[model samples]
Target: MDYDVFDLGDVRLQSGITLPDAKLAYKTYGRLNAGKSNAIVYPTWYSGQHYDNEWLIGEGMALDPSTYFIIIPNMLGNGLSSSPSTTPPPHDRARFPHVTMYDNVQMQHRLVTERFGVERLELVTGWSMGAGQTYQWAVSHPDMVRRILPFCGSAKTSLHNIVFLEGVKGALTADAAWDNGWYREQPGVGLRALARVYAGWGFSQQFYRERIYEREPLGYGSLEDFLVGFWEGLFIKRDADNLLAMLWTWQNADVGRTPGFDGVAEALAAIRAPAIVMPAEQDLYFPPEDSEWEVAHMPDAELRVIPGAWGHFAGGGLNPVDTKFIDDALKELLAKDV
Candidate 1:
């Protein structure tokens, strides 16, 4: 209710199924200038809503709402949008049609152009699955987006990454209460199991080695406390079906799969925008090496590895140092002439 919903009205997805009465939830910061060129599109990550993206937007930060109009579009299965929990009848719960990263960006394009009258984007950036959409935007409409900064994410989901997601998905579906995603009650057991699986991959070995969770801000007494309080607590609040829906989107993400491109390199080469690809040094899922390959294919791009042991969460805005590092990068990128 805090965000505005754009009626998509029966959107046909890439899976060849029509989602009846589809809606896209989004929140905006600042005002669109007269020229409409001061816009920045910052899409949501997996299971994240518009508010979850606010950490990057502030008065002095690169995403400063006072300076630029920042748009945070919620992904389809993120609950706020037309997700399984919000949808009704046939397309509800486990029956929701599969949505791809391509499908997500296409709808976002409608919200930006048809709704806001924005033709050219000053920047398109995000983390995790949001980063996947960033790549999609730059490739799908290279002429519209001026610059991009994708952090802790990839242009294409790696084979290893897909395998990792399989484990997460398996854990959730394994619970009896899941009932093929149609359970009347929330699948608490499955969600907790999924959280446990995710805990192993979300951060680096070094993070656990140093027992950083015991420190301030996190302040957990022990490993079990951190796992139960932080990891389990995060996933338990989310709907199991919604998580599964977004997981499908993440697992199948690839710019190379776009209609015109034969492969990832070809799609990346098509992006004409200036890009700064950032990957965490200790990220288990999205390693710096993968980001290096993406930058190599991009026409104009450079890799900036975020040095930290927070792993993928380094870009998740938990650590102030990492957050500042990311903000500084965006500041430098936005200052560029291109």
Candidate 2:
């Protein structure tokens, strides 16, 4: 395996169920300074693994390995971590316990502190559900995280976001091949349907109107080609059960749900770190408006809207321009003394 596993033994989840012999799959970049003060935690996003996060890390980028120690911890149901596909029976497949963003960050805290002997995080950042974990880390252990940069994500899953996820869930479950998640083989039909449902919300209408997919980097001749080649192709490699498991985590994410915080506002108020909340202006689900409210409640945060029609994928690192915008913001945030 390219990554290392931190055996968590039997973990009692927030849902009150015990996950037997739980493990966290992670990969580290660079070295922890002698003071262990240069550590940065960059958790994985929905349907993303450690390697998928590498696009934001390189020799001279804001996440440069040479200047800081970076840790990418896979979310629980992302296949590599104690996911439905990897876990043994009983808690495997359809029986995988519901994992919340709180559960994810808690385990990540264990990995960061117990495994690495790190006391303070220089920065905690991510995109999408990974951003949700970023907020969770800031709220759950505010003293430990010095700074945060959450892009194309939110501190709470909006009602509309939850409904959108329902449509994605329904598409997958509608397939007879799914067999209520007990499929003996991959549920190709459901996976494709899910991808189709996702395609609508993943990007802006302007992106389609402009036919950006036909251009250089994407290079698809037609919409069908883009749908089949890009959308379907992406989901086809992922396990149906694993996708659904992570979907549950995404739909239910809320930093306020953490104990002691009454609601999202209170949780946002509790974050003591400097933050840069970046939302894609054209993102259908995670709009800049939602980010505005989050920034309003934060003690030390500013809203920076990503100006583009790439929608949520604007922060997905496909477009070099958007990537540079995000990277530049991170560079500025890291330069600040917190």
Candidate 3:
């Protein structure tokens, strides 16, 4: 609700589908310098909004507002943005067209350039799906960005990632109440099932072995208790159709197919911004090896595995140890000469 909307009428998607009334929801922190060279764009991750992104931002932190003009743009298909749940007829629910991470970065490009008159960016960084957008920005407009830090994500979606996402999509579509995304109400049954699927994959095996779910902030008595009280409760509040749209975008993420690349190697070769590819060691969805492979191909990129048992959720900054690691990495990245 604290964000502003920028309407880009009838935006054309990469698939050649036109999305009418296309808009972007974004929040800005700190004042822009006269030169606007201190700007940083942070795109949201899947099912994440600006609020979730601000946890890692504060005085002297990774995204310190005092020295940087940070812009957090909600990714398309998120409920707060121009998503299936919020868009009007002809493109409502499952009727939304295919959109890629490339499209999302283009919109962010518009928000900063046209709205703020910022031609160059100091940094572009994010986590997970947000990181996907960061990757796209670096490859799509290399000259505009000086640095990029993508955590727990990749420049392209791997075969292993797509298979995991298929399970989630299948679970949601399987419920009778889903009605192919035209449900009269939110599909509670399917959403609950989808939550269960996420619960299984969101954390590491060590997490369960140590019973971390019963720790502070969330003290569920049993596995069922955590599933219903935490997982199910969290996802059922989200729009099912919008979730599907984000999933599709995430599954099909690839910079190789975007304008300039003949192949994945070509895409990696196109990057000019210095990048830090941080992958969580225990993440099954975006394994460190996947990021390692992409880093090997890029001209100016390095791999830094997040050592922890939090899996994909390690980037959330929920645990102190994980938070400190992120802060340290970001501080080091920002201090480097551009």
Candidate 4:
């Protein structure tokens, strides 16, 4: 649907930094039941706005407004929310302090508690970086939530992810237009290069294989045209700086290390919510095995491998069928406990 702004007074970031003015853009669907037990959260993935996750949302879907309340909160680094690119000068990336996934959760906490007056959550769910924050919420505020669904996400951002993020930053920093993260008035060509990097890694070889890549027979153009369409149609439409800021935050997403919470696995093991870890069968970024590792340790966690060729992109759904994947899983989770 549509979202407004959430104002959490004098928000403090994980970088030991504070901003007197903090806002998180978000949207809500359905109604919070009398007991407030119907409320579920669907936080956005990297660079994603609340609208991006609406593909799976419909009248009778698992997250059906008829049955439950769904609220999607935009992550901080995303341009739609308070972020490096959106905030004015002196608050831009170069001067902007680091932000951790915990920082994001803290803001979400304010959104749920203050804005919505939600005392307890039926569930906190998300994909990719959104999933990571869902995990963080489970660990940091165990008693506040009833269940969690983390899709194609990891407990911690891997070193490989970090290195990759650094490379994107390097792409922007190296580009003459980036101006060391100080460019504010104009578009950064380096950011476009960063998006190109995403074009390569965001999906899986399996996704490009066994047919979505094929054309003519399917009635589309040649394979080359499809690839070209993917880049020009998707990447070309997104703002480069916004994408880079989102990428930077995602690459470094680690609730434990960033928050100085050293006992990460222990911390995760203590999550009180019944959890469903949905790992993509073909995902390389946040492998299914990692979710299995997490599920094993969590006091109450289950592993649900999504059988799909979408890989890391197997989330919130790019198409209707993709959307159904999320709908069915959430329906099951909502049925089981929440």
**What's each prediction's clash count?**
0, 0, 0, 0
2 or 3, greater by TM-score? 2
lDDT of candidate 4 at residue 119, scale 0 to 100:
82
lDDT of 3 by residue, 39-106 (tens): 99988998888888988889979789999999999998998878999999999888988789989988
Highest lDDT scorer: 2
Error of 3 at 208 (Å): 0.6
Root-mean-square deviation of Cα positions for candidate 3 versus the true structure, in angstroms: 1.1
Error of 2 at 302 (Å): 0.4
What local lDDT score does residue 6 receive in model 2, on the 0 to 100 scale?
98
On residues 1-338, what C-alpha lDDT tens digit does candidate 1 reach at each position?
68899999989998899999999999999999999989999999988888888999999999998889999999999999999999999999999999999999999999999999999999999999989999999999999999999999999999999999999999999999999988999989999999999999999999999999999768999999999999999899999999999999999999998888899999999999999999999999999999999999999998999998999999898889999999999999999999
lDDT of 4 by residue, 1-338 (tens): 35789877677676768865777899988888888888888899876789888876778888788878888989886877777776776676666556678888888888888888898888899999989989888877888989898998987887776776777667655777666655654444664666666655666787666666453322336555654565445554555566666676687776566344576687776788988889888787787888898888789888988887777877747645566776787788788844
Error at 210, model 1, angstroms: 0.2
TM-score pick, better of 3 and 4:
3
How high is each candidate's TM-score? 0.99, 0.99, 0.97, 0.90
RMSD of each: 0.8, 0.7, 1.1, 2.6
Q: By the TM-score metric, which is better: model 1 or model 4? A: 1
Show where candidate 2 strays beyond 4 Å.
none
